[model samples]
Target: MFARWVQEILRSPLLRPGIRSGHRTSGIFVPVVRGSSAAGKIALLERGIILSSVAYLAFETYKWKKGQTVVHASIKVDDIIEQADYLYGSGETAKLYELLSQYKDSNDAELLWRLARAARDMALVSTTPQDEKKRLIYESFDSAKKALELNELCWAAHKWYSICLSNVGDYEGIKTKIGNAYIVKEHLERAKELNPKDATTIHIIGVWCYMFADLPWYQVKIASALFGTPPSATFEEALEYFLQAEEVDPNFYSKNLLFLGKTYLKLKNKSLALDWLTKAKDFPARTEEDIEAMVYVRYWYI
Candidate 1:
């Protein structure tokens, strides 16, 4: 049946259009005369069949090789997430977000927390419109929330949730932001307690303390009145956390040095402030925040 089909296609009128073989005078291949014998037409059909078979096989082989290449290069979910984490560490938030956003609906707690962190970081340095920033922050919060729902004991999930909430707090009203700030502290403390060696969490706690400490007296009074003794820290308290974080992981983040500098200035130690800020200025810029911190250090120094 297959052979008959091939014969039919080869002998089809479309392919059999007087395909003359050679120039009679020069004996070179050219269309000069039509076939005059039955045998000649049969030979032409046979040659067409052979050529068609070769062409079909060649096409099929090409497609098979292409398919094999795709199969070999395909990545597993774990491998993809691992690569995304590397991108995240390098401060490539856009690439990290692009790689992990496809897993937003995933139930895996680890993946969710990573996605949340990526979204939060992306929003922090985002140059987009206010609405887009809000969207990214909310998305970060949502992903972190989902991760905690799946496994509340996961320290990274809690940490990422707190970080996302902090970002969300910026757009919220003063009362709400103050309340969220306390929650952020709570989660950071929990994260630190869960993993004492985690320098990032310790650094975040230091940053949290520094932010509240630097708040103006009037806002402090308002927050105290509203929340009934809101969480507050002095530059001294902030410095301790920052130093502890440094002890655990030296120079883990450029912002840590920047914050240390700012905290010292707040404490009325100008010389120490200048020293720390100088170090921050010299630190290699890894992220947008790092570059911003460098600019801040120079501006304050001048």
Candidate 2:
């Protein structure tokens, strides 16, 4: 009886497998047996399970590949930054600039600020034409500005931006230089506030104080005309900043030593002036700035 029922079901028109255009039916084939209905349902469930597993595996594979790519990219960026820093610390400004200039359009605030610093240093030591020097300085300023825009809290960005701003003022005339004085001070203070341990930022703040303290009478008039309350500092204030910088990092910068000597001279302390000037002259000349410091010491002191 069971055999007869199976035969009848297989002979049914609904259960018959037919070829259309000499092609098999585009569907799962299930045998029409005693329990054809149940068998069909089971086959469908198995197909669904197989397809779900394949899709799950594919999705997991995609995620893993994406994660690995992101990690690799991060490591590459870190390596580049580390190499750039090494070049900079070694005082290879040209090499540092060459390495970092390739990434001038990078979105990384860290890279942009460092690139700006390299460009500024290059401009300082470059014997290029005046127009070429101006172009480089302006480029440095633009890079620093972009870095600040990308990250407001970046201490290095703020520091470089302020330095580049001051550099730009050199070509813009005395009025512009005096006009940017307060802006430069503001950014330097912000940079110091963000990272108090940065000896370079502290030293720049000291320079700011020194410049205002020794402002010429005509420039002072220009500053007065530009702002209602023009920035003012005394030789004593400049001395304090320079001393604080030295305390933070002893013998870190030759220029800082030179400024200390000059500030003491302004205050009429011949003994301290001579002492600091001697130190400045004796400081090692690793970079152009250090060489300039030695020359300044000799010209003004010895």
Best by lDDT: 2
Top candidate (TM-score):
2
- Against the true structure, candidate 2 has what lDDT? 0.66
Per-residue lDDT of 253 in model 2: 68
Evaluated at residue 55, the lDDT of candidate 1 is 35
Give each model's whole-structure lDDT: 0.65, 0.66
Q: Report the C-alpha lDDT of model 1 over 111-156, residue by residue, as the tens digit.
A: 8988887776565542556677689879989999999999988888
List ranges where model 2 is wrong by over 4 Å. Answer: 1-75
Query: Could you give candidate 2's per-residue lDDT for residues 1-302 as a string of tens digits?
Result: 54354335444465333200111011111000110122233454454345443332322232224333211223345556655554554455566676677677889999899889778766654345667668878989999999999999999899888888887887787677767877888998998899877766776777677777777888678778877678887878878878987887687767778888989999999999999999999986544445556756676568
TM-score of 2: 0.72
